[model samples]
Target: MAKIAFILLCHKDPDAVINQAQSLTAVGDCMSIHFDARAPRAQFDTIRDALKTNPNVTFATRRVKCGWGEWSLVQATLHALHAAVAQFPDATHFYMLSGDCMAIKPAQYVHDFLDRRDVDHIESFDYLTSDWIKTGWREERLVYRHWFNERTQKKRFYAMFELQKRLGLTRAIPGDITVMIGSQWWCLRRQTVESILEFRKQRPDVMRFFRTTWIPDETFFQTLVRHLVPERDIDSRTLTFLMFTDYGMPVTFHNDHYDLLLSQDFLFARKISAEAHDLRRRLGVLYACEGARFRISNEGRSLFTFLTGKGRTGHRFAPRFWETESTLGRERDLLIVLCRKWHVARRLVDCIRTSTGLPCIGYLFNDESCALPDLGGIQDSMDKRHRHRRALLRMLYEHYDSDRLLICLDPSNLDLIEDFCRDRSVTRLLEIDCDFSDRDLIEHAMRVGLAGDGTPPETLARLLPTIRNDMALETDTLRDRNFAHHSRLREADPPARNARAIAAFLDCSEPIAGALATTDQLFAE
Candidate 1:
């Protein structure tokens, strides 16, 4: 018996909007669309004509010229809500969405899910205690008057804001309202929507106050709903699954994210690309289906959190060809293995992996093959670029979730080697002296294309000394190769000797004999 009246604020992509309108109306739901006044008149006409025959669809009479972070956005939503309420008397709930939002679940599933719960689904958090807003003005946004649109009239906006600040001009919220902040997208029960509109009519002064507030759209309805509705009747979370970047920009969904979107428990997703025709078509088919349960999976959330949250290691300096600065932050429990020979590095990594059960990666900076074999075919998927390499390292650090990560690097990778040595995160720097003659080092360098002429050998000659100097100045734990440890690592049963040395370096409490036994099994591989 429950029905949803979807209010959409559209700016562009009339065709996509039309598709969404038709799909929602097909299930007996009503739709009210408010196309931005700034958009081309032709686009509005096209959408209106396409949905003219559908009795469930209506358009707001007043088209507000909406701008980012302006009061007009809320005005547009209100215009559409008024129209929807007047036209669809039987509608039980109001769901707010945008032109790019699409139903990730079936329409029937959404209706049933909402009908089962009487609580309104919207993200409302106490602005003072919450860290929701990533950047820009927070408490000041409400305390000061914002007269100009921040996007279009940036200079006037800031100038007026600063002028007000200097003049000590401040405003206080009405005593009756408790300010809350959240995402602009929301779903409200019909009663709650009517209460909000009724409050707007009764409190014109409060509405005017919000008009002068910055980014009022995010705060206006959120503050009102909390003030009008009982705390028990509200669920402080959005039904729409929206993600933002570290810089507070929405992450746009593309065709490849179709499966990920389906895995979320949220009924809808926003900011979908208009050109993702395949994603739209597939989701449209799924939306029209009946009796289909929402598929819940954490893979999407896990991947998103890894990419957006934990993956950002806060490395101050990105790797650049001409830049010599090291990555800024200290990586805890990280070990850098610098060696000239690939086989020797491989053996050392294998010995450590077997002995300590630690995660070890080989040739992380190598352009030839996948550095992370555990990820399976990731190297082929992305281009061999500095950014991609940095991403890979971030993923490796996050994926292992261990106390220690062992990374092997060829000494010829001077840029990466220098950066790693200077990085505070690297706890241990192990330089293995394989005792290769100058001719051998030169030959190996030439094979790897590092020997462009005379430059490489000179660079290679200074590599160890420079690293030693950096370690002495920057770090407390630097293990240089002495004759005893080198001889042990190069012995006939080198894996056992290598394991003992590594165990000692790491200060492992385990018996050396046990580690030696494990090293034999590793060599059998």
Candidate 2:
């Protein structure tokens, strides 16, 4: 196994970044560089002073602009690669890293395992479905599209949708591409590094697109390599790999799950706020023989199953239809924010209790649970069932929070709720809104809680008067309260409807991904 190295590339110094970097440098030799010219010169000044005693640290040439539309990232990657090679020429592979990442495993164990991969590039990855490519998105790319001139911006919906639909029917299209690259950090062998560098020297187009294109470095590298060597043995599934023992086509994030892949796994270990200090803490542990393996909790997986189940962010499928209804012909918008976690359900339960004045039935169903029979008296919620004879007792519970959820109900479901609320006095109001009249839906009610894990409650609080005035809520008691603000349903966020994009993405050639000794246009027309 080659000695693992730390290639810390950063732009600015946040309060805890350097402290974080110091933590990550434990597993191997460390090289630190800043894209100094494009950012404030004093960005990581405190970091430099702190590291003055560390003789092995290296810095990039000052005044270099690591712009979005240029080969600056490649430049930075190469800079670290070239420098690391000089310091340790005999090392077999180098793990490219970012300042924000923390190694979940011990350093020696990580290096030893990383060094053992059969392929040159050990970035864990799988092929992307047509959906991801057409609808491929993240915060950064969204920012890029916003910078588009008016024409290009509109061209996206039309062009992307058309291409995506076409791609689905003809999945073997030659020049078009698919496959999401793993993140910027990959356990790449020295050979892959040389190949990418050689290509940089030979193909300015690749470099130009990387810089000028708003594509993040993660997708850019894999795309470039795939176009170069479509048949290569590259692991498309990078960050969360070890759990997957299968090497099948159409690789997905779900292949090797740690029971429930909670939001914590998705967020990786570092917070956007404390990311700076993670490096040092991680590095210290790496030196102590811990590298980068993250321990996952079971609760996370259960929640993940819930969130990703509907093919939304993190839902895994549940066997039966779990209480959902639809307004098939209603020209209304239903903006649903759901996750597979019990906490999300619990929170929603609370909201429902406060808003709807009706008592609720909280049923905890087992996978073996059968459907409930419908009786004539209760109301229905979308499509979920409630009233039954044999399995009735096991499926019903008193929900203190059901009324606030505000769903149209069937008679059986209503009766179920009434039955479950034992001894408690409950009042049933038969009022319902068919034309979107009730504006206090949960989506509009919770904007304050959604605004940036932030603490601007006063700023949010001040807007209450205007909101109350608009709603025509007459009472003085309602003035300062955080009430539901109904939003007009617009076309569901457009990029989400990537009709053209999805088609184009689906039809692209599969990655000849794997150990790349010969990726010279293997899938060319």
Candidate 3:
């Protein structure tokens, strides 16, 4: 088979991409990469070093900012494509790839698909025909995002839908605002890629639109291919969709279908077990693993999507997926508890053994519940004596007695944690004060799934702690337009000199944090 070129777009994905590159190399594909120029030089240096050992790998000297709804990412792709064409002029086919995508099918199948492919058969070009622009489409399509944000999105959506409807789009008798997924992963015959690049050189307008469109890469590649060759051998149905509802890897069971896909090198998947031995133990699984990726469990895979990079794409491939027969059976889970809020329960819980020396898990809901949605309209006035205890329920059944859980607490909500520890068989509880670690909002934004709606002083307390800066507790809240003021314990405010620390050891802004002392400025003893 002639050589296939892999164009991998990435940022902070060295490990996964490198591993997949290992697989591709084993299967024999020449690789080129475009690392985001926006990343600090250190990242590129590391990536270049990691792949320096690969003979067929080429690194781009030109890097660009890969914006989400902007033309930047498109420019980078074209630039890389130009570079890849120069280096591998003899390469027969080009496969656009991403750090997150792994090829589970045998290379021969892909090679065969490309060998029969013609230069005319691609999606992106035909959409650019002379008739296309006459349909009131030009660089305006690049500004499609104006239809996405603030003022004009709703109007633009209906207008565009009406226009497409007016165009007699066959895919929908009604109108479905459909666009190809993305060129983050696509395959093109070498001649076709060359022609597209040549076309790009000739038509500055086409190229400009590609550069500025919110989703340029996908549109450029797919639109051209579809435009030029609507009759191409695109296996739209052959593309498989996988969802890993299990843990690590599939339980080995001999079945002919599985064997056939493995033998023929087609994509078929089974259930797997996903487990992490270090800090948390997520044993067994509730679903199946399709590819060597995707970690699925009883919690299903939605909550774990971001952690594992499961995008909106319909196809899935979890190479490490497996199935488990639960002795526990199909049962619903209930409740979660936080163990550092209540002092009555806090005194009963050995605060020495939680948080620092121990892994004290916690939950807190303070300030107000006016924000929470309710099922029964249950409230302080809903029951007798105007009392309805509204609260969040957290359940912890798997208890590790020997392991200590140091719980950092919010002073105002101390009762929640203390009560939880008292009810559960906890080995020990060490409560620490807050530290207020909010300086790194870049990473925080992604982990917390912020709506990006410009809500100030957003309460991100529920976000996973792995990515959270402990700063929920401190900062000047006396008056700020971004967020409302919180109680002292939640703000990481330092205690008065000679004042007792009320929360976790790291609670104070500076000095000794979470050090236990009485209100008298001395040990209770």
Candidate 4:
């Protein structure tokens, strides 16, 4: 079995660091941890004692006095990486992680993904040509030599850096090297790490140059890897997820972000705040459940099940609908209705909002006539297509306040919805039923100006049944598990029926239900 050397950088938040380390016990035998030397000794001792029993864990003997934007941060990571390589020389890969980051997927899943691949997973982009610099992000970090007091005048120095950029008096950018900047999170092959260490030894000038640059940690490894690794072998996508807020800081993951986080295909997620103990505990529990799924091994059979649940039959499918209705009844302003039919979804959204006076937003998949561009290619595997779709939706969902938002995505994306609902206490999921026959629906869709222009008739003939079958399978599974809170509304159902369903889901009073009924009747006329 191939092993991974985890290089974990931590500062404060000892419990979160320790919890992250404990979760990796199943996948790897070794970890190298380095805490900021500037942190209090008491905290360091607490972390040391917590992991003392783990014989495979090693602490960096020469920890750097790390400071943000200083070379010390890079030095601390290097020290940990060196320690990790020395302790676990045979480990095939090195994963750079932080105390705030936790594995969102099963440890085994991450391990398998890395072990099967020879390519290095490092996120990088050319600084000058990248949209980031064009969009005015981190532009002055490299072009200006910034100096600041670690304690007092950090913001003052930042202002000076901006002033220099505005005046176009920026210092000379090194012409010898192509500057690559991106997220610091990376997973490198052992040979790649060794190559980096060799480069550091031979090119002290580059190190000296980067040492004076602001936020060198983000650009240093990325730039070096670009020069060392072949372009084809470098997969410039990090497996770690970081949600950046509008304020230019990472948004801390909380309980509400649970569903959104699971929707991502990334292995790790970061910025779980120290104050959120419940969220941390919930993450631990969720990780354990995901880890169990990965531990099941029956050669090709388990792999099939892992990816598509091919051989996993015989398990009873039961959805616990209405299980969280009472809890949801306390306070929930959003009702998500997901259906493929836009006209039906629009009506459902209107009914919910008019009946309950609650804010509702609905996202309908593109109608057949207006199919999505072949962004993922026609031959892309189902899994890859699903991942691409989920990533796009995850970005969209970020705009909504998860607390105040009721999300209703189309049923075509139910796999994503089911995964999202796993960690969330949604008030209710309204599955809208489509009643038209395939031939009749296509004819109606064409007449209604919703038919796809690009999709051939034969393709639509095949695609519609597949979509219907998938929705049916998903409905059956969700209904079995979430029967209590799960309710269905037929497209041809009476307007009163729609009103009652909407009112019931929103947990509104009898008066609101009557109002919805009246509104539905008025709309029908």
**Regions more than 4 Å wrong, model 1:** 305-511, 514-525
Query: How far does residue 208 in candidate 3 sit from its true spot (Å)?
Result: 2.3
Best by lDDT: 1
Minimal lDDT window, size 10, model 4: 295-304
Each candidate: what lDDT?
Answer: 0.73, 0.39, 0.42, 0.66
For each candidate, give its TM-score against the true structure: 0.66, 0.44, 0.39, 0.56
* Each candidate's clash count: 3, 100, 96, 19
Candidate 1: minimum summed lDDT over ten consecutive residues — where?
478-487
CA displacement after TM-score superposition, residue 315 of candidate 2 (Å): 18
Candidate 3 per-residue lDDT over residues 242-274, each given as its tens digit: 344345332321222221222222222222111
Q: lDDT value for candidate 2? A: 0.39
**Model 3 lDDT, full chain set:** 0.42
In angstroms, what RMSD does candidate 2 have relative to the true structure? 21.3
Per-residue CA lDDT of model 2 for 1-525, tens digit only, reads 665445566666544556545554534446545544655757657667776676555565433555442445656666776666666565566665554444444556555656555454533243444333334344333223222322335586446535645665222212344434454656656666667667778866445445533444555666656655545556554543222112312222321221222212222222222322334443344445623444433233332232333223222232224223311112211111111122333343344444333333333221113223343423233232332321232222222212121222221132332332221222122211111122332122233222122213332243344444433422222223222321111112232222222222222122211111122321121
For candidate 3, give the lDDT of residue 21: 60
Model 2 stretches astray by more than 4 angstroms: 14-21, 43-55, 61-63, 66-75, 120-129, 133-182, 227-232, 240-268, 275-525
User: Model 4, 1-525: lDDT tens per residue?
Assistant: 557778899888787778877777544547899999888999989989999998678888687787777888888889898888888878888888888877766656677777777888988899877775435546567767666634457688768777877888776666677889888899998999999989999998888778878778779999999988898889998888875543576767776555445445577888877776777777666655644432211122121122243224343233334322222222333356666566666665676566544545555233333223344352134444343543433333344433444555666454456544543335466776676578655654444333433334443464466445655775676666663456666657775786677567667776676565454433221
At residue 51, give the lDDT of candidate 1.
92
| Candidate 3: stretches off by over 4 Å | 116-184, 229-525
